[model samples]
Target: MADLFVSETQLPVEVRTHEALSTEELMVFGQSGVKEFEIARRFEAGRAGFPQSDECALAFFEISGRTRTVIREDRLAGGAGQPITYLGFPPARAAARRLTGQGVVSANSETTCLSRVDRAA
Candidate 1:
């Protein structure tokens, strides 16, 4: 099983990486004895018409070798017609943990559920 951790912050990328790494290392190593891991963050894209910038911290670590069957679907928008649903191959649903200053956040698998939006032609 692979674990993913996310943190929302306004700190610079470098500083955020260091902070998240320090926190994740301690938590993961202490709980599961994981030493090897990777940390990533999105870099600023210097382009026009880009939305507001929000920095985030992410960490990926190995927990165990486990596999599961699941389906992920997304709707594709195109010409004036019924939307098409794309089915993703059953992927290895990973178990993840998120660390927060106070404590772990809610662990419900589904974060947000959205209903289809209809636009009149």
Candidate 2:
């Protein structure tokens, strides 16, 4: 299984496998940068039996810091949902080349373009 970490500090975090996490535990982790979108993505991926490859692993961190904060607060307040508004236009794509046996290709091809997104969580 791939490891999970806090993007800002690269701190290692636990990955629960057997039991469901309590709401309190989720709240604490949320404070540390784990957003609902990431949790949902992981859950869906697991349900679909997708391989926990490094490429898919990096997609978990593709959320902008501002959007993360907003989503966190909205969840805390029990808000149904809201649209994300980026201050500016979409960011330009930069190739993250990786040298595989096949050839050089984008490492983060699955990355979602979240503005000002952090690297880890």
Q: Which is the leading candidate under lDDT?
A: 2
Q: Write the per-residue lDDT of candidate 1 for residues 6-121, one digit (tens) a residue.
A: 23342223222433344334335422212112121111121122121111111221111121212122325443433222121011012222223324232222112001101110
Tens-digit lDDT string for candidate 2 (3-96): 2222313212322221244434443555322343343234324432333343343333333122323221123355645433332211101111
* Top TM-score prediction, candidate number: 2
What is the Å distance of residue 5 in model 2 from its true position? 10
Relative to the true structure, how large is the alpha-carbon lDDT of every model?
A: 0.22, 0.30
Give the runs in model 1 whose Cα sits over 4 Å from its true position: 1-67, 70-95, 99-104, 107-112, 116-121
Give the Å shift of residue 30 in candidate 1: 34
lDDT of 2 at 43: 33
| Overall local distance difference test of candidate 1 | 0.22
**Candidate 2, residue 33: how far the Cα is off, in Å:** 10
> Which ten residues in a row are the worst by lDDT in model 1?
112-121
Pairs in steric clash, model 2:
7-120, 7-121
